[model samples]
Target: MDHMLRRQIEKIVPLTDSEFDHVLSFFVKKKYRKHQFVIQQGDPVNYEYFVVSGLLKSYILDESGKMYIMQFAMEDWWFSDYTAYLNGAVANSFADCLEDSELLGITKENKDKLCREMHKIEHFFRVKSNYGYVALQRRIFSLLCNDTQKKYNELFELYPSLFQRVPKALLAAYIGVSRETLSRLSISSGRKTQED
Candidate 1:
């Protein structure tokens, strides 16, 4: 599990064994079962989690209880309600395990301390933050401009594993389409529908 984190960080900056050991000291490992909530709406956000295994989805519910998934965090992905995590506020969204998962969580204080003490770690996080921002922008652009078919194709192109792992209904929701519409799109695109 620690190796997973080391690999992720090494993508941006290589770490010495001692450096990796120092970095690992700041995180707490946690496990969650499928469908368990990692962070709940209105709860104080304590830490941002790095996925070591399995999947999690972060989402919010509208007034009428329509769920809008904000992001999916899988192996090597980082996830938290940033607004709350950074500001010490209550969460406005919920993060739930989509599959039984293991994660390493770091509180803001620990993260700050780690960054202050390690230049390479700080640089790694900065790069990661930029990537996260770009991904968020791209998602927003797709949601605003792309038609259903395009959205489906883009999502499939970007995260093909999601098709196998996530429910069709959830995929439809993510693409802002109905399940029936997604099924049609799947068939037309030569992909298996959930029923198939």
Candidate 2:
């Protein structure tokens, strides 16, 4: 499990064995069952979590109780309410497990301390943040364009396994479409549905 995190970090910056161990020391491992909340709305957000296995989603609910998924984090992915975590504010959104999960969480204080102690660690996070920003921009563009089919196809191309793993209704929500509309799109595209 530790090796998984090391692999992810090494993708951006190479770390020696001792350095990896030092970095790992700052994180605390946690496990959660499916449907369990990792971060709930109105609660303080403390840690940014790295998934060792399983899946989780971060989302918000509107006043009318409509859910809008911000992002999903699967194995090797990192997630948190960055606005809350970085600013030391309460979470406006929730993060919950989509599957039984193992994660490594590093608190904001520990993260800052680690970065201060290791310049390479700071570089790693900066690069990761830039990538996250680019992805966010692309998602914003997709939502603004109002092209459901394009969004569906782009998601399918990027993460085909999500079709198998995620419920159709949740996928619909993520793609900004109604479930029935998503079913139609799936049929039109000849893609396998979650039921299959």
Candidate 3:
């Protein structure tokens, strides 16, 4: 677990053994079973979780009871209701385990202390946040301007593993398409892949 965390941080910034130990001191490990909710809407969001293994999906349900998948996080990904975690607000979204999952969680207070104590850790988080922002922007642009096929193809390219790990119906929700439409897209994409 420590090795996984170290590897993730080292991708953005190198850390000395002491520094890594200090960083790890701020996190607590936990496990959840499939279908368990890591967080529920309207709850006080206390921790941001770093996935050690398995998968989770963050989503929201509208007043009409339609569910929208906002994001999926698998191994090596960090996930939370960022606004709520940062501002002490109640969560407006839900995070649930898609599979049995292992996670390392850090509270905002501890994370702030870690960042304040280590410049490199602060830089690593800033870079990660920037990357996360760019990804969200890309997703928004694709949703607004891309056709169904393009959206499906782009999602497949970006997270090919998701197609295998996530249910087709949920994938459709993430792409803002009907399951039938996703089926058609899948068949077409398979054919295109074979041709290539």
What RMSD, rounded to one decimal, does every model reach? 1.3, 1.2, 3.3
State each model's CA lDDT, in order: 0.92, 0.92, 0.91
Q: What's the TM-score of each model vs. the native?
A: 0.97, 0.97, 0.95
lDDT for predicted candidate 1 compared with the true structure: 0.92
lDDT of 3 by residue, 62-122 (tens): 9998889999999999999998999999999999998999999999999999899899999
- Candidate 3 whole-model C-alpha lDDT, 0 to 1: 0.91
Question: What tens digits encode model 1's per-residue C-alpha lDDT throughout 1-196?
Answer: 7999999899999999999999999999999999999999999999999999999889899999998888888998999999999999999999999899999999999999999999889999999999999998999999999999999999999999888888888888788788899989998889864442
Off by over 4 Å in 3: 191-196
Residues 103-142 of candidate 2: C-alpha lDDT, one tens digit per residue: 9999999999999999999999999989989988988888
Which 10-residue span in candidate 1 carries the lowest summed lDDT? 187-196
Pairs that collide in candidate 2 are: none
Model 1 TM-score, all chains together = 0.97
Comparing candidate 1 with candidate 3, which one achieves the higher TM-score? Answer: 1
